[model samples]
Target: MNIALSNTSDKPIYQQLFERISAQILKGELENGYCLPPIRQAAQELSISVITVKKAWEELERCGLIHTITGKGCFVAELSSDRKLQIRDEMISKQMLLDTSYYKSFGLTLDDVIAMLKKVY
Candidate 1:
């Protein structure tokens, strides 16, 4: 597994770790049963505090993307294709709502948002 952490990021180190790792897992870059590095190891590798790694790992577990085994380490959870799609959609939809709300707050109309999205796509 690989990750890049930005020191000047607005997001916390743990959240940045969590989002990137989770996105990688969802993209099948991290296979089922693949064990993530230990908290201390990951922290050392990333040059961040171990507590940050621990917090991110706990969040991945909370999202059901991984599971921790006693005396071992966390492994990516096996998910069915349908389940993967469901989880992916749920995650994407949540982000979309947040993004849309931001646009709405800026007084952007549906047509305005669609046009902007079209330009990007």
Candidate 2:
């Protein structure tokens, strides 16, 4: 697993970690049953606190992306293709809901937003 942490980012370290890992899992970059490193080891390697990594791992578990097994480590959950697509859409729609609210605040219509998105995208 690969992760890049940004201290300068507005998001907290744990949140960043959670997002990166979840993205990888959803995209099938981290296949089902792939074992994640222990929290302490990950913390040492990433030079972050154990609590941060733990929090991120907890979030991953909460989201059903990873499962922890006693004596073994955390492993990516087996997800169907349809489930992956459902999760991808859910995540994107959530972000879009927030973005849509922001756009509405600026008095931008859907067409205007789509146009801007097209340009940037």
Best by TM-score: 2
- Model 1 worst lDDT run, 10 consecutive residues: 79-88
lDDT of 1 by residue, 80-114 (tens): 86877887898889889999999999999999999
- CA RMSD for every model? 1.3, 1.2
**Please, what is the whole-model Cα lDDT of each candidate in the order they appear?**
0.92, 0.94
Model 2: colliding residue pairs? none
Off by over 4 Å in 2: none
**Model 1: residues with Cα > 4 Å off, grouped in runs:** none
For model 2, the local distance difference test gives 0.94
Model 1 lDDT on a 0 to 1 scale: 0.92
Alpha carbon lDDT of residue 86, candidate 1? 84
Superposition-based RMSD of candidate 2 using all C-alpha atoms, in angstroms: 1.2
Candidate 2 local lDDT, 1-121, one digit each (tens): 8999999998899999998999999999999999999999999999999999999999999888899999999999999989888988888898799889999999999999989999999
